[model samples]
Target chain A: NAGVTQTPKFQVLKTGQSMTLQCAQDMNHEYMSWYRQDPGMGLRLIHYSVGAGITDQGEVPNGYNVSRLNKREFSLRLESAAPSQTSVYFCASSAGGTGVSYEQYFGPGTRLTVT
Target chain B: LAKTTQPISMDSYEGQEVNITCSHNNIATNDYITWYQQFPSQGPRFIIQGYKTKVTNEVASLFIPADRKSSTLSLPRVSLSDTAVYYCLVGPDYGGATNKLIFGTGTLLAVQP
Candidate 1:
């Protein structure tokens, strides 16, 4: 299986620009999450979905939005990208939700730069 | 979410055992300690997790004290490929949000071959 995959491996955006980063998992996992890694910082949760049609805000959800249209996809949208928004974006999936026992599988990560 | 404190960095030699300790003094009684390993350009991967006592897997071993306030991730043999940042997370092991993990500043383990 392909596990979790994210699109747009690299992107360079100008301030005020908008873009959507796509994520998908073949594992049929019921949980998906988005996180951003800043320099010298730990990953911060952006948004998450427990299943298709169920979404929730996470620790750092101010600059982003997410939707779970189908079970296999969880896309992150950055509206009005700012220089502070530049960071590595990662998509992860887990086997279950509500204290699921399995480990989280992550994507390679998308390198984003807002100049 | 309980806060976790781990060494910002560590250095290890090849073939040596590396144990990275993490402290979570305020860990909730039901919280579980989970460890994740992240490469320079990748997402964090789950290494091991435990609530109490020790849990061993092929990748690493997680040692949690009876009080559940601390945990140690033991890497049996160090190698160049093992050099990466390790994250310690604390949360309910079951019956909580599946992916609401609080990843704090993790320990950067540098293994020199």
Candidate 2:
């Protein structure tokens, strides 16, 4: 199972450009999440979805938007990229259910550079 | 949300045991402790998790004390392949506005040959 997959492994954008990082999971998970990791820092949550059509902001949600159209996909969009937005973005999913563990499987990550 | 604190880095030699500790003083009653390992250019993978006491898996062991304010991840017989960033996460077990995990600066374990 491609536990989790991300598209456009690498990308470069201008200061005002916009892009979307795609995330998908085949684990039939009900919870999907987006996170960003800056150099020398830990991953911070950007947005998350409880299930299809449900999304919510996370710790560092500025300049970012997320959509969870179905249980298998979640996308993170940068409306207007900034230098501060350049970082490694990761998407994760978890089998959310009562009596289930909180183990999250992550994608390979998308490296974004904003000039 | 529960916050975690861990060392920035640690050094170990081949065949040695490496223990990385994390502190989560504000962890709630429903919070569980989980650890993840990440290599370069890859995403973090789950190592092990524990609610209390000791939990051991094929890869690692997690030890949580009675107070539950801290937990330790023990990697036995480390090798170069095990050299990676170890993250300690603390969060609740269910879904809620604050159910998301809180990852702090992980411990960069460098295994020497």
Q: Which candidate gets the maximum DockQ versus the true structure?
A: 1
lDDT of 2 by residue, A1-115 (tens): 8789999999999999999999999999988889999998888888888889988888899899888988899999999999999999999888863111477898999999999
In model 2, what is the error at residue B84, expressed in angstroms? 0.9
What is the lDDT for B90 in model 2?
A: 79
For candidate 1, lDDT tens digit of each residue in A1-115?
A: 8889999999999999999999999998888889999999988888888889998988899989998999999999998899999999999888766342458899999999999
- lDDT string for model 1 (B10-113, tens) is 99999999999999899887787888899888888888878799999999999888887888899998889999999998887674364377778799999886
Which ten residues in a row are the worst by lDDT in model 1 chain B? B93-102
- In terms of lDDT, model 1 sits at 0.88
DockQ for all candidate structures vs. native: 0.59, 0.48
DockQ result, candidate 2: 0.48
| Maximum-TM-score candidate | 1
lDDT of candidate model 2 versus the reference:
0.88
Model 1 spans with C-alpha error above 4 angstroms: A98-102, B96-99
User: lDDT of model 1 at residue A68?
Assistant: 95
